[model samples]
Target: MLPQAAQLLNKIIKLDFQPDIVTYGAIFKGLCRIGDNASALTLLTKMHSAAHCKPNLVIYNTIIDSLCKDSLLQQAMDLFSAIKTDGIQPDVVTYNTLIRGFYNSGCREEAKGVLTEMLKSNITPDVTTFSILVDMFCKDGNVKEAQATLQLMTRKGVTPNIFTYNALLDGYCLRGQMEDAEKLLDIMTQNGCEPNVVMALLEDMEDKGIRPDIVTYNILMDSLCEAGQLEDAAKFFSDLVLKGLQPSLKTYNILVKGFCKKGLMNEADDVLRKMEKDGCLSEDIFLVMTFPRHYTTAIL
Candidate 1:
């Protein structure tokens, strides 16, 4: 279907019918899905030259996503530079893509720099911006940076939501700072913010006032166990029970794995048994049960 679409695009190009930004973005996105990033990048250049039409934020985002997936982090940044040189002002999506791209490419400083640039451009950072930055900083063993970004969010009047807390908690847990993560959870509750950052950001602006969400509880619960903080994990689970939110099977599996990591077979067994009793053990979890010293040591 993509090849046919590309052929159709080429035919359109030949007859002097310039495809709109959407058309180019569709073809560019298709190329990304098929793992032909190099061709996609080249085609992007071709589109620029042939039509002299600047690609929109969507097309740039597609290319940046493809670049990040292809491990071309530097190239992605280079394109970010080109985006401006080519007279394209990046939107919020572009900033998130570049921030994540720099993050995945092991360019932490540059990634943070992109965030600063976004601020200078007056492009308001969204939850995704803070979430990805938190994840990147935390994964890179920069827990303080993660915390600092949260502070920045506060100064900017972007209240920390669950994703913000979950991300910070995850970072703390990853760095063996379970106590700090728990403290963050406490702060989240005290601040009257929801647990998940994504929903928190949306609910504030979503015309309809549906504020009920469960993603933050799930992330924090899962992250706790994944980081081997079983006691805290269980505490969060208990909290979930109190809140009347049914713990999904995925949640139970996370606790079990956490117990298993701490070599507490008894606790793991008990958690699994309870999950079965609750009739929530039907789903499969891709549990990375093998505890590694570090999931990534590439963070510079």
Candidate 2:
């Protein structure tokens, strides 16, 4: 659709109308969207050579982001240098694109090197830079490194947000290190960061006038179920309805499975009946509850 728009724009331009850099940039963006960076680069060249049109920061940034996403880091770097030579300084977005690309390529040091370059170039590392590093490190199972990066961000005067804390929390949880996860939660509370799980963070959210959503309720319910606290799960499930949030099918299934796991067949049947009454029952739930022994113990 965008390419066709570009063709129409060209037709309009030929009818005694002139298209400016923004107009050409839009077309360049459309070309890049179709995974035609080669053509986008060619268009950039033509724009640069044209007497009336020249590429701007947005155009350069778009191409650089596209190149990095495509794993053409060398090409992206070359374009980065070219953009700098054209008197357009690379912004944080440019560095971020390169950092993500290098990290994805397993070039950890190279990825960090971008941060160093940013500091040397007098560019401040924003929350996004720290968040990206923390997320990447956590995903790579380097939770300790992620924690260290979080500390670094704090020391550098960049307050850790909920996402930053959540990444570390998820890392600790993934490793089954609940002790560390709880400690991190304490730190988050101390730092006045909040997420919605009906725990301490729930109070924080309410104090800030932010109501807990369905996803928040689901997380709390699932956590309670996993911890063998079916009563707490049930209470939270009721609170979810009281809060005017619709429970998803997964929410019902979690509660039913929790009851079934504890051999409370009657309660499980009750929940199943409630699900049917809500018009949310599906065949999937029947299968999930039918073969409990196989479902619980079967290995992929």
Candidate 3:
């Protein structure tokens, strides 16, 4: 469809229709969506040569995002420079994309450099910008730096969202600093940010022969179910059973809630039946069944 659209666009142009920037922008987006950055870049070059319709910041940002996703970091950087040469100021989105691209490509220092440049340009870092920094620092096992970044974020009057806290939590969990993780979790709750189950932390615990208790399993299952990963959540239940651990009522409720949220009434029924078969049925399950469908979905 995109190829056909592109051909049609060329025909319209040949007829002297003079396609505006919006038309060209749509085409560029389509090309990039299909991971055909080559074609997008070619079209961008053509747009550069055209006198009437010069590419705007949005178009440049789109291509820059596409290039970054493809790990064409050098090309992305070159285009960043081009944005300035074209008298277009890079926005927060532009800096964020480049920072993420450089970090993803193992160029941590370069990513920091991009942030510095952004600050120098007086583009105040937003929550997303700080979140990325926190995630990057945490992933590097530099919890100290991640903590510092969090402090700086607060000083800058930016509130740390779930992603920010989750990164730090995972960092502490990875290093087996449960005390600090718990402290952070407390802070998250106080700040109205619920801590999420970090699967990587679970995997690391397993690798270290550290057994997680029922509560930990419940947290993980709840997280998975919330993410609509019903199958995975069910597998975790099975693992809980195989480990001679009892599935609490909350476990069944989580799965039922997940299935209900996805509109899979039959699957939800099967779970309820299984709960009964295991002699785990309780009034809570009845309450869950009695609740209106929308009510069940909302509680999760």
Against the true structure, whose lDDT is highest? 3
- For residues 1-300, could you state the per-residue lDDT of candidate 2 as single tens digits? 865776676686568566787788788788878888887887677667666667888899899888888889889889989988999888888888888888888888888888789879888787878888998888889998998999898889998776677667667766766667656664554554432342655455456455556665666666677667898889888888987889998899789878877777678778888888899877756765576555444411
Model 1, which residues run further than 4 Å from truth?
Answer: 190-300
Better of 1 and 3 by lDDT: 3
| Overall local distance difference test of candidate 1 | 0.70
Indicate the residue-level lDDT of 257 in model 3.
77
lDDT of 2 at 99: 88
Instruction: Pick the TM-score winner.
Output: 3
Off by over 4 Å in 3: 194-300
Clashing residue pairs for model 2: none
lDDT tens per residue, model 1, 4-34 = 8887888988898878887888789898999
lDDT of 2: 0.76
Alpha-carbon lDDT of model 3: 0.83
User: Model 2: which ten-residue window has the lowest total lDDT?
Assistant: 189-198
Worst 10 residues of 3 by lDDT: 188-197
Write one digit per residue (lDDT tens) for candidate 3, span 35-149. Answer: 8888888888878887789999999999999999999999999999999999999999999999999988899999999999999999999888998999998899899999999
Error of 1 at 71 (Å): 1.2
Q: Between the candidate structures 1 and 3, which one is better when assessed by TM-score?
A: 3
